[model samples]
Target: MALDTGMKCIKYLLFIFNLLFVISGCVLIIVGAVIEANYRTYLDFISSSYLSAPSILIAVGVLIFVVGFFGCCGAVKENHCMVVTFVVLLFMIFIVQLGVGIASYILSNDVERFLHENMLKSMRNYDRSRPGVIKTWDVIQHDHACCGTNNYEDWTSTPYGEEYNGVPDACCKEHVSGCGRNIFNFSQKLNDINKEGCFDKLKGDVEENVTILGGIAIGIGFVQLIGIAFACCLAKSLKRQYETV
Candidate 1:
């Protein structure tokens, strides 16, 4: 009777974990699908460098969720072989989640650093009198000339282009209208604008996906630990059942 009770407890715990996993998994899948749908928008808003990998991470999250659902079912049935199979599959999912989380962290950090350094360098070389403030500005202008057409035209022609123009003034500093001009102020202003833009992109991406990713990571970690505990308890119960029989 005690052995049976123990087995029942394990089954209940497995059910609970499975339910939680399914719910979280479904949420993750939905979020991933949304991101995949608007991937181009994300790429255009944020750095495209991180887009491919994050999309893959989302796909993996969806797969783990589906696998987790099956594992839960297997555990609830009290089929020893099925239980073992579930455990093995859960372990694999945990491993993959860990790897993907780590990769995402590293990739995000690298991208952040690149943006920071590049923006600073561009700001340091900004010249108001020049065609564009810094390298990044030049790149943005070249790529998005039509996107910011009105602002670009104003910046290029007007005397107080740095002030009256719709473009962020920080990127468009005043250039002394003479020969042998010093552009230190112009460079500083450009860097500030680049920094602002970099931060904006980072914030936008985080707003879009950080919460969903974080929830999946936490949910998966919790499920894996609980699943392991339940598996151990189930194994002990099975051992007792065999001894009694």
Candidate 2:
């Protein structure tokens, strides 16, 4: 027996939902990749665990494509089994996405303390011969156009800061060899050096990015719920049709 008009509409709606799922999957993949890249730049200031959220997002995104295809096929073939499987898989993805959203929010709140402590520890390593340490600090200082963790004064406690008599050369507003030497106080050479601290700058940027990630995850999760509903209704219709046959 053919489906009633309402059932026919539900079938088409399920197909539309599956298409939306595929598009959202692409969006998640892009979001995950971009956030992961941003996190790498600040790896020195963050814990390695932070990377897992984005990595999972990418994985979930890939799984969505496969599950969405199954949903599409189920809706087209009017197969109760396939539609039910799609609903289960989508629910699993929804749970994962929700978890990621919550984790990102918690991480965002803890970022300030985490960055302050880690940045200070990393600053002490600046004077060492480690190229990675040197480059990380220099990149942060130069790229952000800021000085030490809290201020240029924060560097004075470090050997490199004492050796330079002020802050690292990367803290100079204009890149001049030895320009940062002997420069102390904002009044000494107001235009010559960056008196602002890197902590505040980095903290603000990181929090904003993390918040965006959380929003995306939660947003996608809610949309998945709708797709799950549509799939379930269609599965019910198919089951009833089979009973009458």
Candidate 3:
């Protein structure tokens, strides 16, 4: 009777854990989607391959839902095979998530130079006629409160620089018609325009995103350990019960 009661408690705990898994799955999906959308906004500055982390997270979220179902059914029915399979799936996913989290953190350290190169390349190709380039640069400058890849002076060599003799109006501290005109004048430049580079600001943002992703992945992976242990205990109890019967 004591053993049966203990096994029953473990089964109920597993059921509860599975419910939490379902909720975590939903949260993971949302996190992945939000991050992916953010990255898309800066697609011109980032490699498409950088998207794989979020994509994997989204897939893992869906897989968690399936694994949760298996866990719930196995616990409810005391099905040994289902419970063992749940453990296997949970363990495999835990490893994958941990690996991705570590990899993301390591990659974050190296993204600065890559992003700088891309930022400069995109800046060189900037043209009003190219709406994509124009909009991206304008949005980046205005939103980040930054002027060029390195500094406001960096734009002085661009085609737009030749025409305007100053930074883009988006770089103006207090935007007004032609506020950026003649900003090369040291006093006016300091007073009217943002002097910082977009590269450092953007690099920090990207690194922060990846770091958050890493933290979430590793955190969830460790949390899944509890579920794995519960599944294993339940599977073993079920196996013993079957042998005795």
* Candidate 3, position 231, lDDT: 90
Candidate 3 overall lDDT versus native: 0.83
TM-score of 1: 0.55
User: In model 2, what lDDT does residue 39 have?
Assistant: 57
Q: Rate the local accuracy (lDDT) of all candidates.
A: 0.54, 0.83, 0.83
Candidate 2 similarity to native, TM-score: 0.78
RMSD of each: 9.8, 3.6, 3.5
Best by TM-score: 3
**How are the candidates ranked when ordered by TM-score, highest leading?**
3, 2, 1
Q: What ranges in model 3 sit over 4 Å off?
A: 1-3, 30-45, 50-55, 125-136, 157-159, 162-165, 181-191
Which window of ten consecutive residues has the lowest lDDT sum in model 3? 39-48
Candidate 2, residues 163-214: lDDT per residue as tens digits?
8767788999998888887776446675698889999888888789889989
Per-residue lDDT, model 1, residue 95, is 74
Two-way lDDT contest, 1 vs 2, winner: 2
Global lDDT for candidate 2?
A: 0.83
